[model samples]
Target: MIGVSHIVVDWGTSSFRLWALDRAGAVLAERRSAQGLAASAAEGFETVLETHLAALAIPEGVPVMMCGMVGSRAGWVEAAYVDTPAGLDRLTEKAALVPSARRPVRILPGIAQRGAQGSDVMRGEETQLLPLIREGFAGLACLPGTHSKWVRVEEGKVSGFATFMTGELFHLLRSASIVAPAVDGAATVDPRSEAFARGVGDGLAAPDMLGSELFRLRAAWLLEGAGPDAALARLSGLLLGAEFAGAARFGGRGPVALIASGPAAALYRAALAQAGVATVTTHDAEDCVRAGLHAAAVSAFRLERMSA
Candidate 1:
């Protein structure tokens, strides 16, 4: 309570990101590493974290707020899940405290969607949605990742949502499946390429044939010597296309608030255009994460007063 500072962390399954913020919630220093939740579990979460903290010269008593898989059953602590219709208050209220840390450390819980839709869970992404909550956004949102999420929000609270494993499938099919041959060593899927568009159209038109469509990637390569670029593009397009089709029901909710960074955003935008998404609102993923964490810091720590 006395450090008058905040260390906000987005500790994910495959990567770790931390931001050091001063009293006003402005970032003072930041770091990112491959020491993700799973990796940190082996290296010791405290050991990895304290190393970064020491490098940043963060003074003692600084409270740390974290979100993501770090709070998962396998990570640092099982922070539990906050059910759907969750809001800012619920997140702060349910934050799990880590008594073993040398400093005050709390990890925010993930959001869970249950029942007929199939049991679905999202961790770090829930924090990224906080900016929308701040703006009282009422609409659908697409958060793309290994396990992509299509979220529905009424004002600030999440109403319902769905997940798509588009990225995961793309990786698996390209790396491990029999379909790997066609796309192996292929160039990265070009967002604007004809193959990308065609694949998207094919997926959008006939999601039922995804299995067959994926197989065609190899068959085409073997038969016509179709290049890997096309193969890779078509593969990505098909997977993302299927994802779009799956989330098509929510498209009518309004323009989707797309929160993604770098290539993912570009790929989604291209696919959205092909998917007939007329209007798209994009938010910088980093900006949203920072704002969301700042909000959490305020709600959980009354951050400014402490820093003052």
Candidate 2:
């Protein structure tokens, strides 16, 4: 067991998830907080960790490995994004193993994709996908979130991926947009509505027209006298439906797996079902960043042994 303690931290934009693990990857103690990167920008990063760790009573001298925005350019340390088609070692090569009095710390790097056309990067979801790596699944893995990702995993290695700003758009439109003025903040999913299904159908049919169509949610309500409730449902449908349609383009005919374990995962499941696409969803399970950290840790340990 190395006779030493280890802590895996998945600190994202909005929340922090920490797990104290044994040598066998078993979680010994777990803690969570609202002190995410976005929240801690005003306060220093180390203060956020100190406050949470003090609450968790985490003793000193625990080896800690972190994933997510904690390694972003604006996070705790600036970690470079590892290019696609790269292995764990390549990603970790750019990670800075910070000196600490408590224990050795390692931060997982985000993944980046660029071309003559443009570029995109993921701060956290890449870590989650690392745990999903295995043989025989030569298709795409969809991780739905503020920025949903469609990762192409071929023969257990990541080939490429695309990120869509679906979640952020949904949040902005639902609350900030004027289309659904009275849209309830605590609305629930209504799977039976044709409005929702219509949004999905239209989105799947023409995802490229998404920019123009988003206006329909409000126009359908304000101009056509649609209800707030209906507009809300349609808003959710448009995004999830668009994601389903856009993500499907990556895998083509092969099977697709949704790896996220949260509310967004549930919405995606329902959307895929409405689309008649066979799908599976996982909930309240391993966090993506933690899974990615574990994967990176194993790879690091293997490399360390190999070098020895």
Candidate 3:
């Protein structure tokens, strides 16, 4: 509480997370909510942020560093994208300043990839990748979420990456598609289920059969009497397996480094194993983002004065 020098925010499209941290990068206080960028845009970014800060009794003039959709065009302000082959230094160098804030506020820039494969971009995930980049990590990394990203990092620079809509598609299919009825309960998947393993096998064997396999979930439930839980688990495996199959096309030969948290992390780990893709390491999503934000804050605000 005494040395708290900054507040870090990870403002995603549908969620908001804030951390009050000491100069040592240790969390002093925290806040989270459903008031993400979209919702904050409606209620007002400053108002929403202030309300949360007020509730936590955060002092005025504390430097604030934010990442994610908060920097998007639709959020508080546009923090432009840093092109591929970027590193931590580039990200820190290009951080955008928010205009007219009572306190000093900076939004970390997202990384963009553009070329013959069209264009792709990520906002908050770049922050999560900072620690790895700084450590000179070189490997394939997977960050699973609503839009999962498979990245190629070589010697501390992000060379290329691809996004998969597996999580989004799973949400759509379970909530709005014909498989909705068969995907009852809490929309959860059991990684240990045989049905899940079978689904992964099916997906890895024939990724192109995604459409037909999705239909089979409904058919299996309607005709073969498969339970809703099994159906849900199977659907999760199938989608995740399909994502792995697609990522394999990129020719990443080594074990993958999985960056995720909670349920998504468990699910991805299981699916990757089922698909025969070994995981060399795992990093907690929360820790990675916080570490990245802290690293950025150190460079941006010169926190080394206190931390040292």
Candidate 4:
């Protein structure tokens, strides 16, 4: 077996993913857990990280590169932000070193956008964009998640971007709002459902009416006998459609390249299609992050030979 040479971590607010990579950047082993920044902050970042490394039997001195909330002010070490119109190369150049670690540890800095539209920032998503930058991809790219991001890239630089609270809103509505009972115990929405498509149309046509439309879901359940599945589908469609509508206003002109995986990807594709927006490309979020981390590792550790 090839000896582990570097460790890549994508640590977020609620989840953690670790990959042990050889010099060639191929994964030798992986570890994933719910021990995110919040948990790690309480348990001690060093302790959480060392325990994971010990379980993987990774040798000491293997350099570690991390991205995401792990670099936020609330994380192990604050990595600061690189302003927008930023290039991927700048991310590598500005990586912050974590002091007092047994092994070399560096955290990649995130990108920030400040303008009349207000300020916005992202942590781990910057690493995921390295592959797009390397490929010279220009246009709109959407990263769908808890807080979805719509980024506009031009000539290998992040020109501008926006964030939507779609996923978080969905969680709140489904679990804590008046619409909760309608979707309680319901299975995930089927992306192809007609109810979902209708909801998308409703959202695009009247995004300003989202609050009223949400109440309509409950009305449909209480008055018109709507099924829980249909209500769930409608809710999902409404939220995603509103997000796409907002993105359309700021995404400039071009086809969207969606970076996502699994069910979220399918749902986004369906929503976009229903909204009449063509998706020119789709990249797996996991794959992009891995490739991005590999790229960052190469740039950060230039002196190290990257061949097994």
**In candidate 1, which residue pairs get closer than 3 Å at backbone N, Cα or C atoms, i.e. clash?**
none
How do the residues 1-308 of candidate 1 rate in per-residue lDDT, one tens digit apiece?
13337999999889999998876678888989999877899999999999999998888778889998999999998899999888888988899999899988999999998887679889988899997888888788898889999998886898789989999998999999998888878877899999999999999889999999999898999999988888999999999888888898776335788899878889988898778775458887877787787788778987666766
Q: Once model 1 is optimally superposed onto the true structure by TM-score, how far is the C-alpha of residue 87 displaced, in angstroms?
A: 1.1
Whole-model Cα lDDT per candidate?
0.87, 0.70, 0.88, 0.88
lDDT, candidate 2, 1-308, per-residue tens: 23324667888888888876656566666888788887877787767776666676776655567888888878877778887775555665666575542446678788887784248787777677666663245566777788888778766666788888888988887777765474555366575677678788878888887777778766665677767667777777888788877677675224567776656666777677777776543423365556567656655544334223
Writing each residue's lDDT as its tens digit, candidate 4 over 93-159 gives 9999999788888999999999875699989888898898899898899999999999988899988
For candidate 4, the TM-score is 0.96
RMSD to true structure for each model, in Å: 1.9, 3.5, 1.6, 1.6
Overall local distance difference test of candidate 1: 0.87
Question: What clash count goes with each model?
Answer: 0, 2, 0, 0
Model 2 per-residue lDDT at 66: 83
Name the candidate, 2 or 4, with the larger TM-score value.
4
For candidate 2, the per-residue lDDT at 207 reads 82
